[model samples]
Target: MKSAFAAALAGAALVLAGPALAADPTGLWQTSTRSGQVEITKCGPDLCGRLVSSEGLKADPALKDVNNANPRLRDRALKGLTILTGFSGGPDAWTGGSIYNAEDGKTYSGTLTLDGTDTLKVKGCVIVPLCKTQTWTRLR
Candidate 1:
């Protein structure tokens, strides 16, 4: 009877610990180009990343999104821009999201994959033939 109870407890422990042991990509990450840092976090039931800092932002604290196609949004600041939006899934991969590029003032369908413990693969696509992938490293 004791052995059966021990087995059940062990099974329960494994079930409870499964999600925590999964690959998690939530943290501050440095871009492959070494131009900016994005901080990923939970947004409602999904994930989102914001541009916390960038080389341009560091150079001129008052940097604006001048290249934005929308003239109204051109004056918006880039420092707190929501670059990654409404990403779903986790552990190893995340998809069904959009990535905003301030440089071109464009948004692309994107995915975030946890490549390793300290590496993340960010992919953005306008279409299958027009996809771009960048490897970002964890900063914290």
Candidate 2:
């Protein structure tokens, strides 16, 4: 009876923990600004995201990276721009990444925390104390 009860308890625990343990960040997500969608995928051992669509893209089909710091890259299109790069961590959280903001023409050190299965907390900082956080919702 004791062994049977213990087995059942373990099974229950596993089922309860399943979703939290299986938080997969690879998917389409809407930016917090509601201005664009990013498709996140596995890149090497890290995760990265690319801009698949945006309000700006809809207005101008041939939108370029006009604000990019690199003058040579100014001609690159924003349709498939790599905005998130080199994020490495776990099933629910990630760090050691760089987030590029075309609006400001800057890249910041970034960290991501997957909140539940649908919400993601994205943070970027120029320095430790100077950080901004945004909530991104899963679109797929």
Candidate 3:
């Protein structure tokens, strides 16, 4: 009877500690420039991110997607834009993604790496060695 109780206790502990052990990037994160916050969520077998909120949009209600390369989409609202897509990898490292730069209206190869419990490193590469990285802080 004592062994059974101990086993149940162990199982309960595992259940409680599982998330803490795994590196999960799915959460609201503030961009390094503090211009916007991106919400990362699981999309099928991969991960995707969207611009949920932006300081610029808040300050100017008339802001639109003027920087989009496609002229038709330029009139669309900047909110809820899918800026990151096709990321596929483990919790600690994600690759093979495309990051859309709304400011420049360009896309680049993207990689995401979890730095710690509250920080994420987002890198966009024009080429393998030529990359720009930004540190994002988890909001929740």
Candidate 4:
């Protein structure tokens, strides 16, 4: 009976720890610049990241046109669109993903890696690839 009880407890522990081991990057994160915060969440089978809040953002003088008429800026979307998508690799890392830069309204193919419990590195680029990398710190 004691052995059965021990086995049941072990099973329960595993069940409780499964989600943590899954390594889903769904949480609030602070931008590398320490200027804003973004919320990364799972969208259906993929992942989507968005700006949850920010500081030092001008209300009158717009920093940049996110959705410009220029073809080069077509992939970029307003803060409303999911910036991170098409993630199919794994919970700890994602490939074949795209990140939308709202500041410039440019979309670039990218990859994401969960650096720590609350840190993520998102890198995207144009010519060199893996040119622009930002370390996002998780927020409570």
Give per-model CA RMSD: 3.1, 3.1, 2.5, 4.0
Best by TM-score: 2
Compared with the true structure, all predictions reach lDDT values of 0.90, 0.92, 0.89, 0.72
lDDT: worst 10-residue window of model 4: 56-65
The list of candidate 1 runs beyond 4 A from truth reads 1-22
Task: List candidate 2 stretches off by more than 4 Å.
Answer: 1-17, 20-22
lDDT of 2: 0.92
Ranking by lDDT: 2, 1, 3, 4
| Model 3 error, position 134 (Å) | 0.4
Q: Ten residues in a row with the worst lDDT in model 1? A: 17-26
TM-score of each: 0.84, 0.86, 0.86, 0.72
Q: Estimate, for each residue in 19-100, the C-alpha lDDT of model 2 and write its tens digit.
A: 8655889999999784789999999999999999989898997999999999999999999999999999987899999999
Collision count of model 1? 0
Superposed Cα RMSD, model 3:
2.5
Pairs of residues at least 3 apart in sequence or in different chains that clash in candidate 1: none
Model 3 residue 47 lDDT score: 93
Q: After the best TM-score superposition of candidate 4, give how far the Cα of residue 83 lies from its true spot, in angstroms.
A: 1.8
